[model samples]
Target: MYDVVIVGAGPAGLSAARMAAEAGLKVALIDDQPRIGGQYFRHAGVRRIGGILAPRFGRARYIHTSLSTLGRCGVEVLNEATVVEISADRTLTVAFRGSITQLQGENVVIATGARERVIPFPGWTTPGVIGAGAAQNLMKASGVLPGSRVVVVGANPLCLLAATSLLRCGVKIVAVCAPSRPRVTFNALLRLMRRPDIFLRGVGYLLMLKLYRIRMLSDYRVTDVIGDAKVTGVITRRFAEGLPPSEERLDVDLIVVNDGLLPNIELASRAGCEIEWEPSTSVWSPKRNADFETTIPHVYAVGDCVTASGVENSLLEGEIVAISIAASKDVGERGRLRRLSRLKWRWRRLQKFRSAVVELTVKESLDQRPLTDDTIVCRCEDVSLATINDALCQGVQDLNALKAETRVCMGRCQGRTCMHTVLALLATAVGKEPDQFKPPVPRLPLRPVKVGDWLKKF
Candidate 1:
């Protein structure tokens, strides 16, 4: 049994592991990916193997330094290890390669991170259509460009970063379509103005795009993606007030769409941790206190898994959670409250920035008219959105009732893709608010695990 088991290897997980190990706690860092860096700081190539770092110097350096520091700190890094289940007793059933293993830990830090949100449109499943974040992952981590010429669509700060990264990597951007309106909350704007570095970063992104002569379409939405196997172009419509309905076809090899991100909270929810829906990010995040401890004691969550904050905040949170856990064990001279206070200071600073950005960028609910009766909702299980609507029409208002009827959110993805859409449709059909509807039912084996591997636990 280890003193701490970190269930991811991103910036947050790495920072947590480093702190735990430095505090003399036995730390085991596990991740499904082949390397230490999770999606945000994804590192490619073998250690000591030669490869060119992505032009984003800060991100690349952070990943490299953190991995090296973790190694030096004696943290046992287990790459490509998937945690399939977490028991009440803190036993983690993990699948590594073709076998399964049970690992016990006194404390657990879940840093599973966030997945990019992609809203389906016509032809979205095509090969050339991918999430804006996924495009970044492909270019930054895999060293493979999503396309030579691309059209980026989204309203997040990450969308701008993705565009900048693509330009640095010599990928030509055809156009950027941002659906955000010019008018934002005054409070959010004021908070953003206070952070000069963040404001400067925003300016720098605009300047880079200007210098590269990339076309930008503010208040525009990608109505449809056009192509067969590969994307040839995207259909876009302007969102300005009093604007006539004009459709434009922008020629591009790839369409990178980013709506926003939702917490990858399946494991936490399945483990019976309370989840709270945040309208700002339009997703449920695991409930945690000031010290990052969840409703269930000893199960802490850090990083994007708990909040919609970005990488810097995630790393700070990880450090805080680790210190808190260490203090609980009386491993160091530092008191828990004192360590927590320091973390709170940093967290407050970052939260101001995150709140401002989220307020300014989160997508408002667009026209989500329910899909046809036969339209598929859960792509993983091929469950139709039509079937889900039919169940709701038959008075199945509760999520569990709908689950029993249509099994829309009961697939392998476990409602990750269809939950929000299903809830929205149900609310529309029943004349209730989306938040008023019951949340999706949580289940175990939060991630897909082989049946044979699960049986090994017995």
Candidate 2:
């Protein structure tokens, strides 16, 4: 048994572990990835990919330092360990190297991070079309460029950053398309200025695009991807409230798209933590107290898993949760209460910037052109929008009923990619809010495991 078992090795988990360890508590940090850094910090330094942009992608020194500190402070780090289940008793069932083991933690921290929210469009499953996050991972972790020529599509600022990164790697960017209006972007910018570092990074990305003379198409949405087996190009339309939409076709080998991000709340949900729906992002997150503990006693969540705010917020939250956990043991701390107060204050202040980012990235995108009936909603099951619509029309009013009707969320992903979209459509069809409809209960064995391996564990 450990004092605390943090399920993630990203900034939040690392910080939490370090703080807990230093407070004289035995801490264990587990992550599914072979490496410690979570998505935001993974290959942050271009270890696998070497190019002119290599310096920009080099491993983050802070993460490196954090790793060393964790080791020095006697915090156990378990990489390639997937936590499949969490019990109310604070026991974690983890699968690693084809075997399963139970770990009991006096306190548990779920920092599983967030997943890329992909908005399915026609031909999105085409060979050359990829999520912006996937493209980033491919380039940074595997040293593979997503494509020679790419058109980045999304309203999120990450799209702009991805475009710039691809440009730095000598990839010819066709254009950057965002569905956001100029007015919304301007307002977001004003709010962004409160956090100058983030605001400056965004501005730098845009400036880079301008310097390259690449088109930055505002209020433009990709209506269709023009390709069969592979993406050949995309069809974009500039949408305005009153004016007729203007259509343009861009020829490109690759299409990178991002909607935004949604927190990975499956573990918490499975642990029976109460969830709260956020209207801004149209996603549910495990509810947490100011101290970061969830409704489940001694269970906590932090980082992007709580809110896809940013790395800065994640790091701060990690520290806060760790401190809060440490205080329970009557750990020696010179200014425990004072520091916690300050961190909470800083965290609350950062919410303004986070809200602005959500508004800028998601507000317009959610109002996107309705998906065509033929558009695939569930890629794994090949369930189409028409099928889901028909099911709703048949009076399938609940998530489970809809799933049973069309097998929409019953595929390999088990609704990770398609559930939000389906839920939104269902809520709209039923004339109810998303929270009014209950989401399917999260089941155990969250990740796929072989029956043979499962038997061996027993």
Candidate 3:
């Protein structure tokens, strides 16, 4: 048993563990990855790969310090431990390689982070269409180039950053395509006007594109991808009001598409935590109070797993949640809370800039292109969109009923990927607003548990 068990070793998880352990709480940090850096701090030694960009100076140093602090503070870090289930009694079932174990904790912090959102278009499943983040992971985390010539497609500030990084690593960027208008949120635009340095970074990226002569395609989308076994090229079309159909085919070895991201809320939902759906980010996240405590007592969540906020907000939330937890234990620690209050002020100040950028970049809605009847909406079970629509037309209004009829959300992913699509289709079929419809009902074994491994639980 431990005082706190953190279920991820990313920025938020690491920050929480570092703070909690420093406060003399026994901390256990578990992550499924082979390393503790998660996605943001991903590094693959000294080998340089095409399209890989180095991290920012401050971020690099902070990650180094955090890792060193973890070692010095004696926090138990399990790198490859996959948490399978969480019980109502705070019992955690984890699978580490061939072994299964049950652990208990007084407080549990979930920072499992978020996964990249990949909206399937025609031929997206072909060999070369991959998530923008997946390309970054391949080059930065694993030291392998996704492809020599890459087309970066998405609508986030990160997509631009990824393109810049890839260009720096000597990869040829065929083009950068975004479906949304090239506009920032009003608040973000105001903040950017005040911050010249941040404003210059955007200009710098454009200058780099000009220097490299890379093409920038805004108000465009990858309508169809063409390939056989491997990607040969991509088809892009402009988005105008009933514009004439003219497809621009770009020859490319790889295509990276990032729609946005969704929080990994499977475990939280299965553990019976209340979920809040945010249409702006198109994600279902846990409902937490000002103290970062979830509806379930002693369970906390921070980082991108809670919102679409980036690394800075995640770290700040970690500290805030840790301080709140500490204050709850010792109400007399006024000094600690005071210091934390100062830290929160600084965090907010820094976040004023980042929140603006995220607000400008996050995907607010699904791809408006209608799904084909033959398109597979649920990739895990190979369930077609037509089957789901058919079920919905037959009076299956609720997600549970749809699940029973079409098995759309009953696969290994546990409805994370298909829930949004299914809900949208159901709403369209039933002529109801998506929010007005019932949300997805979560089932058990939230994390993937192999049958052989699950049998050992007994």
Candidate 4:
């Protein structure tokens, strides 16, 4: 049994493990990825694309130092361990190396991070269409270009960053299309002015676009990623009507879609944490106190898995939680508490910037476009918007009844990709708030496992 078992090795979990281990706590930091660096810290050097942008600047020293510190402090780093289940008893059922085993923790910290919130439109299921973060992983982790010509579509700041990174790698960026009105962007920019660092970051994205001579399409929205078997190009149109029936077509093989992100609350919720809907981001997150512990005692949550705030907030939260744990054991709590308070100040400032980011980002996007009746809402099940609409029109009051009638969320993904759309359309059709509808319960065996593998003992 370990004193602390962190479910994710992202920035939050990494910092938490570092602090906990330095305080002489037995730590077990687990991650499903091959390495410890989370998606945000992917190749953490200031230079983009592993120094392709400039001839100088080596890999980040801090990343190496952080990971090394954990080893020196005797923290157990468990990479490629899939946490199958997290129980309220502080027991974790982990699938380690094709075999299942149980690990007990005196205290558990959840930091599973976030997943891309995909808004499906016509032809989005095309093979060449991928998430912006997926593109980043492909290029950064595996060193493979997504495509020679790419069109990064959406209003997400990450979309801009991904496009810039691709440009640095010599990929031809056809265009950057974000479905936002001038007024909406202006309002968001006005709000962001309160946070100069974030405001400048936004400006830097625009400056990067200007540097690359790429036009920002505030007027146009990507209607479809047109392709056969593979993505050949994309179809974009201006929102204004009677504009000569013109459509802007870019011949790009890869289309990266960005529609913001939502916390990966599956594990936390399964652990019986109380969840509340966040209207700003249209997602649900665990309810935590000032100490970052969830409603469940001894169970803590931090980072993007809680709010998709930022790495700064996540790192601070991790350290704060570790300090809180140390305090319970009477191990250097006074000094740690002082450090936590200082970090709290930084966290408060970061939260303001995050609020501004949410205001600007989730306001409008390519996801705003209404889906055609025949558009496939659930790609995993091949369920179309028309089928869902028909079910709603038939006065199916209950979501389960709708699902029974249409098999909407019965896909392999179990509604991860399409639940947001399902809830929105259902709420709109029933004339109720989206929060009123209960989401379908997530089942176990999140990743498909062979029955034989499950039966194997440790």
Candidate 5:
């Protein structure tokens, strides 16, 4: 059994592993990705700048040193390892590569990170439509552009970053549809002033937007994705407009939507950790104490899997959680407290730096109900809004009941892609807050794992 088993290789997981191993703990870092850098540290064959703030000059160089530290510190790294399930006794059933393996850990740190929140619209399932974050993922991981011409929609700041990257890749951005009106834009710019580094990055995006002559279609939301077989265009309308809104169509091969992100907390919830839906962020996060420990005694939640503040905060949180684990292991309480005190100071400084980022990057929800009534809310099950509405009309009061009635989230994705949309529709129909509804039931095999693979190995 290892002293610490980290479930992601992102900023948080890497930092936690390095620190725990440096403290003389046997560390095993697991990630589904093929490389150490998670989605945030995706380096595609060149020097990567931006994202990570390091003294090493470039992100590529920083990642190099991080992997070097994990190596020199003797952390056993398992790339392409998918943690399928966690048992009551802290045994992690991991599907690594072709076979499955059982890992018993003294302490488990979950840093699975976050996934893009995509609001469904008519024709969003078209071949060329993608999440703006997914578009960036494709570009960052493989040096690929999403499409020749793209229409980026939604209100998240990730739209700005993806647009900048796509432009650098020589992709033509037809338009960027977001709620960038005067008051909201001014507040974001003014609020971001406290963080000079972030302000400069925002300026860089604006400069690129100006340079490329891309339309910053302010206050706009995608009403519908207009395409038959593939993405041919998108219909955008202002959010503040009247019923039967004035629509503008933009012809493009790709439609990248960036609504927001939800913490990937399936594994944590499946492990019986308490979860609370945070109204401020409009995302459900694993409930953690001040010590960052989950409800499970030896399990800890850190990074974007807990809160998607930023990379710097995630790195700090990772270190803090590692200290918590080290302290709990009956390793000289006095010495552990002394080192934990030092790490907490670093954590405070990093948290202060990210406070402005959280304020400026809060996403606004869109009215996705009027999307022609036939939009596929759950792509995995092909469940449409009409189907959900029909179920609601048939006396489905609870969200879980509606799921049973319509098979809304009983799909392969396990409600990752469309749970929020389903919740929103039900909340509006029931005349109650979305948080008032119960969360989707958490199940074992949090991620998809074949029975044969585990039977053969474990």
Candidate 6:
């Protein structure tokens, strides 16, 4: 038994584990990735394994220091460990490197982070089309560029980051076609100024774009990805009002697109924690109280898994949740209340900024381009928009019902890649809000665990 078992090694999980262990609680940190840093600090955990340090910088250095602190605090670190199941008694069954082990924690923290939301366009499943987050993972983890020439599409800010990262990697960007108009972009930029650090980072990205003389088109949406077997080019259409409609084609090997980020809440939902859909972000997260404790007693969720705020907010949540858990255990009683109050005040203030960012950036709905019947919605199950429409015609009224009729979310990904799009379709069909529909039933094992590994648990 451990005093605390935290899932994920992202900013929140790392901070929580370090703080809890520093308070003298036995702690175990688990992550599926071989590296400790999540998306924001991708590949930051690599050290001088053979006496050669990786090129480190701001994000990398901070994570390295936190990892070192975790080591000094005696936290058991389990990299590449997947938590497959959680029992009613709060025991976690983890599959690690072809074996299984069970851990019971007095307190458990879920910080699995978020996944990139990809809005489907025609031919999106082509070999060269990838999510902005996935493109970053490819570049960061393996030093592989997504393509020689790329066109970024969508209204989200992640598109800019991906384009800039590709620029740094010497990949040529053909253009960036955003669906939002110039006014929306300007508003978001003004709101971004509230956080100077973020504002500067975004400005630096824009500066790179301008310095390279790359084309940045506003109020343009990707109508289709034109390729037979792989992406060769993309079809973009201008959507601005009071302007003659025009179509443009860009020759490119890659199309990197992002809608937003959605919480990876499968583990928490499967563990029987209550979940609520937040209309503001259009993502469902594990329901938690002011203390950040989930409906399941002694189980807490923080960071992007709670909501897809930025890295700084996630780090702060980690500290607050750890302090709450430690105080509950009476391990660090002195000044706990005062520290919690101060941290929460900071958190709430940051959340206000987050709200403004979301308001300025997040659209009421995805790109309003007409989704063709041939567009692939669920790649894993090979479900198409036509099939979904057929199901809706047959009286499917909710996501769970639609899933039963069409098997959309029953694939290996467990709705990670496909749920948001399906939810949008269903909500539109039913003439209700996204939150009005019931979420798909949570299934287990949360991830695929081989039969051999399960047997080893015995």
- Candidate with maximal TM-score: 2
- CA RMSD of all predictions: 3.1, 2.0, 2.8, 3.0, 4.0, 3.2
Please say which candidate is ahead in TM-score: 2 or 3.
2
Candidate 3's residue-wise lDDT over 378-439, tens digit each? Answer: 88888887787788778886777888898987887877777877887777777877767645
**Candidate 1 residues 1-458, lDDT tens each?**
89999998887898898888888889999999987878777756412211334564356677777767777878888888998889898888888876788788888889999887776555566679888788777776667777888888876788888898888877789998876565577787777775668678988998999998888887677777677778888888776778785779998998888778888887787667888877667678888888888998999999989875877788888889888888888885556567778877968877887878877784746353212454456777777656676677788867777878877777777788778877877777778777675455456666787888677768
Write down the lDDT that model 4 would get.
0.80
Runs with alpha carbons beyond 4 Å of true place in candidate 3:
50-58, 184-186, 192-203, 242-245, 331-334, 350-355, 362-364, 437-441
Q: Write the per-residue lDDT of candidate 2 for residues 232-299, one digit (tens) a residue.
A: 88999988678798999999999998888889999999999999987888779999888999999899
The model with the greatest lDDT is 2
**lDDT (Cα) of model 3:** 0.77
Candidate with more favorable, higher lDDT: 1 or 5: 5
Candidate 4 lowest-lDDT run of ten: 50-59
lDDT of 6 by residue, 1-458 (tens): 89999999889998898888888889999999988888778863444322234333246677768878888988999998999888877899899999998889888999999988887877889889999988877766665667989998865667788898787767789998887653446655555655777767767888999999999898887888888889899889887899998999999999998888999888888788999988788889899999899999988999999889978888999999999988888887588889989999888767766776687663636438657999999999999999999999988877777888999977889788988888888878888777876565567678898999888878
lDDT of 1: 0.78
TM-score of each: 0.90, 0.95, 0.91, 0.92, 0.90, 0.92
Model with the higher TM-score, candidate 4 or 6: 6
Ten-residue stretch with the least lDDT total in model 5: 49-58
Off by over 4 Å in 4: 44-59, 182-198, 241-246, 365-367
lDDT of 2 at 391: 91
Ranking by lDDT: 2, 6, 4, 5, 1, 3
Clashes of 1: 1
Q: C-alpha displacement of 364 in model 3, angstroms?
A: 6.3
Give the whole-model CA lDDT for all candidates, comma-separated.
0.78, 0.84, 0.77, 0.80, 0.78, 0.83
